[model samples]
Target: MRSAITLEPVVVTAPMQTSPLRVVLDPKRPYQPVPASDGADFLKSIPGFDTIRKGGSNGDPVFRGMVGSRLNILVDGGQIGGGCPSRMDPPTAYIAPELFDKVTLIKGPETVTWGPGNSAGTVLFDRTFTRYEKPSWSFIGSLLGGTRGRFDQTADIRAGTPDFYMGVSANHTRADDYEDGSGHRVHSSYERWNTDVTLGWTPGKDTRVELTAGRGNGHAAYAFSGMDGVQFLRQSLALHFVQENLSETFTKLDVRAYYNSVDHVMDNYTLRRPDPDSAMPMAMASEPARQTRGGRVAGTFDWGDAVELVAGIDGSGNTHTSRSGGPEGSIMGYYRDMPRRRDATISTVGGFSQLTWYLNTHQRLIGGTRVDWAHVRGYALTGDGDSGSLSMGSGMGMGGSAPETTAASRSATLPSGFLRYEHDLADTHATLYAGIGHVERFPDYWEMFGGHVASTVTSFQSLRPERTTQLDVGVQYQTQRTQAWVSAYAGVVNDYILIHYLDGNGAASNVNARIMGGEAGVVRAIGSHWKGNATVAYAWGQNQTEHRPLPQLPPLDVKLGLVYDAGRWSAGALWRVDSAQHRIAIGEGNIVGDDLGPTGGFGVFSVNGSMRLSQEFTLSAGVDNLFDKTYAESVNAISKELQGYTGAIRINEPGRTFWAKLEVKL
Candidate 1:
């Protein structure tokens, strides 16, 4: 007779923290609400994370109320930048989470092993390759279908031997316009696809060399802007070399280099008809592109068994170019033939060293420091007789003024560091930690070249570096049947870059601000067959200079889930609520959009289930917004008037949705 075995229920609502201030998620697992179509969609399932929804896809992610460059995103140890001046495509827009093996998030400035300027946090999407002792092959794939014509397919295949290995990953996703709870259709449709290839060579058990290449493209319709993203194209390449067991004290040596590029296009007529009464009454389109290249070399060392160290040097550079055409029927594709003009360039070089010291059996210390030198140069043309002056009142055009070419440049040297102490309970499975970190951030492309200064003709020469000092504290506990964690942070920002929108133009300025936030979660086993979990996140900010609430902050949000597991199948329910946000800074926000006004509170309910059909196959399905409630996020963009659609000041979420997914491994 054969014996019967039971399997633990899979997490479907939200992932739990594995350690203090750190969360590691398996990208291959199925999640609630809906299967992710992009990186931002996957992040929304975590506490202390939100998205600035623009459409069905390509939304920018915000962590702890910080957006843009404050949140650093790395894919396979490389950085990629978007090209759109209006932020139609963020760094996350180029990432397809399903292709990665693991996603790790480090909340707050707790560590600085990666690059600089990560004031809010750091997120890494990584892929791991195992050495094959003999000839072997593996395959993993999934197919998903849902309401509103949503369909997706993904596949990963690998074959390897002791000395050589190769693997390929690819995915495609598409969705049609979805209706809101009010039975009105929103202009939110999109299609995207990506493919990546990896090759590795292993000469011995301690040495390895690998190379990766990828390409992706997509199009999305937006309900919050006048133009739609007609194209989001990306290309990437990276190489890595690693050697272990070099000597007794020198543990390892690692080196990496990467190149990434993004080419984007936006048009008013491709995805939707141009509003007859809007600013651009005729057909219009713009194309912008950026190229980024960087490299890093680091070594790991151990001093006996008490201390360990990692030191490295890294550098990167990027250039931006754009072109536009419109207002004339005879020049429909003029942008395609026009030459791309380079408007801005940025470069940076930095060196860092981090160490871990084991003081005792129950206590430890960690710290690191880094210094970076940054340079930026911007080009503009104007008729005001002011050399190195540019007008960003409208689009990338010259504002119908005579062209007089000019340029300006600036440089800065900044320093950053962090220290943390951790204590492990001697009698219990728990850990408590406290950390303090400081970072100095150079203004990015948007703050320097995409906006204007209130007091000067350009912001490139006037904007100053931003400095942040923050403290983070957290506790984590785990047992066989229960897991719990809580984390909090408070920070002060000097020369905080604040963007103001007026008369359809954006202006940038510096100010002082204070920010505080926290997140907590717990998962407990009620019985052999039942489990319960809950999580809460909240953030608040104040503009010290203006003595008022900061704009674009997310409200208090909570999530509750219950699951029942029977040997071969499992079912779960999830309830989410968001508190009303009364704080307002009407016209102040980030690069994507400005806040319109206050928002009311709302709640949503969803249910999900999964079944193992066989040893190699699993199926899952879910229904979101069970009550068909109409709601919008507090940190959302203002809606733009379309030709035939009427919407509120902010874009609303989708109505009741149904989806299902199937997976197989061999």
Candidate 2:
């Protein structure tokens, strides 16, 4: 990526990108009134996005009503996978957004430069190194306190000279179980901390090399799942190199290598008492570990000033292993004694190229293509003969039945591409664009290990790659005082992979499906001191094979915001509303969960204020769910238990909560 700096406030009103629906966020900004526990919470502040909340943090993110591999997420250009088969720890769960410099979201399969199978879109959290003109040092720190014993602290420090630099960032956050609007406490408490360090060397004016390392560990309580995350430990390392202006035609060359590992432990005994009547009659614990390694090499070529090309090859490999023990005391730490078993290994290698043709100043054309080779191997490590053994590719890891496994290997070669045309109305400060993209996604480890064995072969061998063909269109309008944008997509998926639960049994299968969605927003500068903005998003889907509405489809949602800004003071109010959802396919869903019948929708309101005390100090505060209204989101998973209600009920959101924050820069 080209390196450049732009000074602007971190806000939702930034100018639109060349790609439709793409949003680039500045993580250092104060636009989000609430403190985000992780990257997922930060995404929730954007329009057209929603999360499947398990509790206060680690909620699964949904874009255009799509989840999982559909949304390819990367941190510092590397992928990180959690060990939990239940997705108790999603990729974002390990990411502390504040530590990153930028978060970019490319909605849909509009480009092929990243990795493969981003049919839903792509999310990138990046931290870029800045060269110092002279010897310098800087620091940023923040402290937060809120209701429910909520508290957080963060610090970032940097010191460097003209040719070298180093920095470190760290944060800690925790919260207790919060009461609902109805005055009932839910099982949602968590504590987390992370620290990252970076070192950089610039040998030449146009060359740079950087190294990064980080470690984090924490535990979180779950309100809807059988087991709580007793431990979430992560370690990461990466090296990146960039050479700009390598030549006139070959303008840039970039390469990177990274390693990430996660150690996770889950147990009912540690966070809650064992349910004697349940299958796990006594305290039990499951420890899982995943290791991922990957690298990418890319270069940019330019032909004159009107045409440019970016080509690259990227590959990644990951292995999953686990150990478990049952019916032990809460203090036993059974994971250490349980036998460790390697269950699965997955890998992918891909090559891609993207081209841009600038046809005059008013029009442009862009195209991209990618090909990937993916492989998966698995084993029945226990040979337990228990068809009910939980496995990664099997259906039972989340909310389904245990999966039977067998030693197996599978491989697939898939191709994907897209073409787009963009037109600019310079005089009117408006732009219009349209594109069509196709992506073939291989079955992930969880999908393979989560499915039941079919025939004499393991389900991992029978599952096919999901194919998505999509068309996207959008328009953006901007002026001195007003900005607006709208984007839409329609797609037909062949061999779409879906899981179903029937009669207490879960199975994975392939089917034909259709999906469509769009998001639109408008921001108007109201006078000099006030601004107003509104946005709306909606998604729809259908199961062609089942002749029913697709499951896990999110309801139409909207947001309205008004902000007032003075020299040193600013305040804002936000209102969010969602329509009720009645369309759902019972017993059918993805790895997350099946549709829980119909759900009612509600609206929420919040207020925020901030003061810029000086160049080095600032303060902010807010009240979320201001009315303390009891409500549940339309796109939600089943709660294991909620406010005395059980059996597939949606988890309630936190009631009226207040928080304050103080920030300092030196």
Candidate 3:
């Protein structure tokens, strides 16, 4: 037999689109700007993706200028919801990208295979399970160290027989406050850890049964908020079953069920001392929690080589509760002893069907439809008499006279669907596609219950479901030496939820809006040992009702990269630039935060390299912001007047930094 051969994968600088409106990423490969600490940080390397920077980690992710529930995020086909009312911990906060095998991103409302209301897009972080031919074992591990006391460790080990398998993975990361280019320290520090275990049984070549459990906890300091995230605890459990090649027509069946919960605590004492002049000057803490349970079942059917169909039903429900206490060493100082108050309960059930018809080898048509029933019941603290004013501690960030108890409930039937056509140019190695999609999204907990209403004391009964109708068009081209893709979308939002902040108080209202954006990228080989790549992304939005520009939209951004590969080692450099944003809606924005004002543009450069030490080990290192440039992203959180932080209105990015990593496989 001939000797086995293998090829090393190149270090990824910018993710290239695999198809129209879709991008696939390899989580195991080394990337520039050091290894990521969380999923949001890793996603930022891709075009058209940005984060609401609040600190060193746990920043909320934004896609195409949209944040919050508009973008659906999933891990192992399961959903995890954060418990912070202020959105300090987004769904991506609990995700450690290094522990997964693959990351798939589908932009726009192009499919209904996942859950409902993904108007922005869908992200799936998946793990692949393999069956052994005989008794076998595998191991993969990594260690990382960086500036400002940054350190990370990860390990994955698996051993299995032909019929049985077991695996476990864990990671830990921490960092201290980082200084800006001017040598001023920002109040940003964090620590996090997570562990997961899996067990599986493979009775036959075409069947699989698996169970998984995970737990994680962490804490992060914030410069934009009055209180820091002192505790973030997560617990999850899931079951999966799959059967393939059942029959000629019944190709496959897949089923999944999961449960997830988040217990979060925020305080001014755990991470830092209370600012003497700030609100709530004494030690205080609030504990908020959420529990989510859901499941999905789908079947795939194929008819010869002409057509295929997939049908599925999915549903999920969740509840939110909170308790608070303040002033250490005094009566009622411990929040743990306070009785938890149930505030909101929400649920959704949906059914979907998707089909693909191969008109010919070069042309195809794809379509899908889904309908969802959503409901919500909110408990509000109401004042006496006819004023209808809410009381303090109502979880609406409002204060009023002593209140009476009240409840409100709302329900809606939503419909969504999409249709697309694709044509492959014969012998040209290119494909062109166009599609249109529509989605109706219900208001989330933060939009309906976290703030006051425009005309009422509360928003629970006044907000309306948002509807989006969009058209997407794109093209893909690939050759022996180059790859390129471009995609664009335009949509109209009816009854769009908008948050307004005035005089330190927040209110929610409905308005009509229009949004448009596009992203393009190209990668080309220059010679035997060199390569070049570039990407650009931009988004624009307007509040049609008021004829003003939408708030919190990211500015035009661009990235350029160059690399040189020698047989055993490689080096790369990246330069990122952003254009100044003058559009402003001031007090109006999303749930995370509102725009401060116009932001000046800036650029930064970084470099990285890697070398194979041996067959089992490899080392990589990089320096970010090599020039120590101090700049803030246009979509960053507004900074508060903290005791020690004297930065600009927005939280600034870290100064010049360095990181190194070591990997081993066995």
Candidate 4:
């Protein structure tokens, strides 16, 4: 007979209280009394972060005023990206947030420890396994149902002993198109599922090895594009080993290797019927895929108690391929007749060293430097294989013709570094810090191969690498009853990649730009049962090359929250406000989507409640857009006219949405 155990009830904290104003988050916590459709939607809780939305799910994450490869996003220390040139399936589409334990965000070009590029920031979703003193089994499950036929199911189970452990997690989520405040459907519907497994071995007293494997697949319907993501398939594998407390001087050694692959399909006939009078006037589909493999070896060194150092060498390589078929009425033989063609290949190797020097109990200094060698190559094919160039250059009116068979490879050695100083005001319980850094970013595949500059230009072979220099400053204050933080950054980018959208077609180019942004938040405990909090974020940018305001920059935004807690019951209210953005440069932006025009802002209010039913169960519910105010997101580029709708309307958000969730632990 098997023994059944009761688990403790989960404490429901504030929706976005991971670390005050910082971008990090605890993925295990419930967000908004319900679960988000994807990782991008969940990032909205962080100040200074926003998403480019075309529908309910798979929105592109935007940090400050930057997008694309400027941001380094990783899952379990590995990189993965959708294959769509138009970004129908972003990297976040594959991540099931609650499956991971921790999510960390490093803003700006402040560090060089992760990978190359990353001028905007670095995002890491990580999972950690704990050792058990005795044999035990644990399980956690959540089910959610909400307005618009939304449904979600998630489960996490683990069994472990002192020397070995294993765990598995599975999730499934689905939703129908939601209606706007005015009772109009937004054409946003999606279904997705993911499963992951892990195994760990504690071979010695201070050594451990772990292996992880995961697979995820999904489909979505878009409101802003003629085509939708018909298939989003992902596979991942990773191995990690650590030997801690090795010696007095050499504190720890760590090594890891990982592989990630994404296979995506986009078409006009899968999710919705093809529009006979639209762009193609026929059924069309394209299949694109990418594979990435990487490894890292690092060690931590300690010099007495005042100095510590972490140094490592890492490398990664990726290949992008695609095939297209069914341009006319027939949908048959699309995959079998279409042959895959290689389009791009990129590889990079780098070494870095970061050190922390404690100047005393109340002060410290930190610095780091890195050097990377990168190689980028593109292939041109003749005849049918020419789909590589045709599909890549379709938007620029250069698809039908292919340059003579040719192969070009470019190489560059880039260096990046940062330095910062910190001081603590013990009496006031506050800390202040400042830093400056510079990074050189190699052009990514989307920038180099996705679109052509002109009929005379083949690939973006002549494009220059981008370089950014930035200064960051911040302050943090904490006490028994209150906590607050403020962070800001300003930077100049040389040879920034910009995509120009014209008459439904687009092209990629390079230009100089300047950017600045900051975020601030404060939280206070009003009484034994009350709490209040507020946060604000703003960003500004300029197209230095064109002498005009940069496009796609978000305007000033603010959020306020009030909460009441009594024993096992809790309730809260949240309000969000945004300011109109008048700054505009009509046609320039990043690869994901371009700036359509200036946008007016609006405010929204929501309320939530939760109750602990028992030691092993809990219930929570919430209503978003409580007033049912209609508004459009500021970062979106698709206009109602662009999506074949009447007038110049923007995609309106969902109306008053009611949602409830049940959680159980055993």
Off by over 4 Å in 4: 1-22, 327-333, 381-405, 451-459, 637-644
Q: List model 1 lDDT by residue over 233-326, tens digit each.
A: 9999999999998999999899999999999998888888777787666678888899999988999999988999999998889999988876
Tens digit of per-residue lDDT, candidate 2, span 1-666:
943332222233222343456888777665543678898888877777888888878888988888888899999999998787767888889999888889999988988989989999999999978788888999988888999999999999999888999999999999999888998788889999999999999867788899999999999888767678888999999999999998889999999999999998888778788787754556677788899999999999999979999999999999988877643544434556767788889999999999999999899899999999998888752233344533322222333444454677878999999999999987888889999999999987656664322212445556789999999999988888888999999999999888776654456789999999898888888887788888898999999998999899889998888888775777788888899999998877776667878888899988888777777878888888999999877767544444344553788888999988888989
For all candidates, the clash counts are 0, 11, 0, 0
TM-score of every model?
Answer: 0.96, 0.94, 0.96, 0.93
Cα lDDT for residue 461, candidate 4:
62
Full ranking by TM-score = 1, 3, 2, 4
Residue range with the least summed lDDT across 10 consecutive positions in model 3 = 384-393
Model 3 over residues 1-666: C-alpha lDDT tens digits?
A: 944323233467789989888999988776776678898988887899988888888898999999889998999998888887778788898999988989999989899989888999999999889787899999999998999999999998999998989899999999999887777788889999999999999998788999999999999988777778888899999999999999999999999999999998888778888766765566777888899999999999999999999999999999989888764564546788778899789999999999999999999999999999999887753432322322112342323443455777889999999999999999999999999999999988777765322223355566789899999999999998899999999999999888887766567778999999999999898887788899999999999998999899999999999988775788889999999999989987888878889999999899988887777888888898999998988996544554346646888888999998898999
Candidate 3: residue pairs that collide: none
Error of 1 at 413 (Å): 0.9
lDDT of 4 by residue, 1-666 (tens): 844333222222232323312466777656652467788876766778888877778988888877778889888888887687667777888899888888888888877788889888888988878777889999989898999999999999999888999999999999988887877788789999999999999866588899999999989888877677878899999999999998899998989999999998877777778787765556777788899999999999999979999999999999988877664446545553678878778999999999999999988888899999999887742232232321322221222443555567788999999888888988997888888889999988777766422212343466778899988888888898888888888899888877776655455667898988898888888887787889888999998998988888889989888877765767888888999998988876677656768888899888888787876778878888999988887787344223434564467778889998888989
Model 3 residue 305 lDDT? 97
lDDT of 2: 0.81
> Which scores better on lDDT, 1 or 4?
1
Error of 2 at 25 (Å): 0.7
Question: What is the alpha-carbon lDDT for the whole of candidate 3?
Answer: 0.84
lDDT of 1 at 93: 92
Which residue pairs collide, candidate 1? none
RMSD of each: 2.3, 4.2, 2.6, 4.0
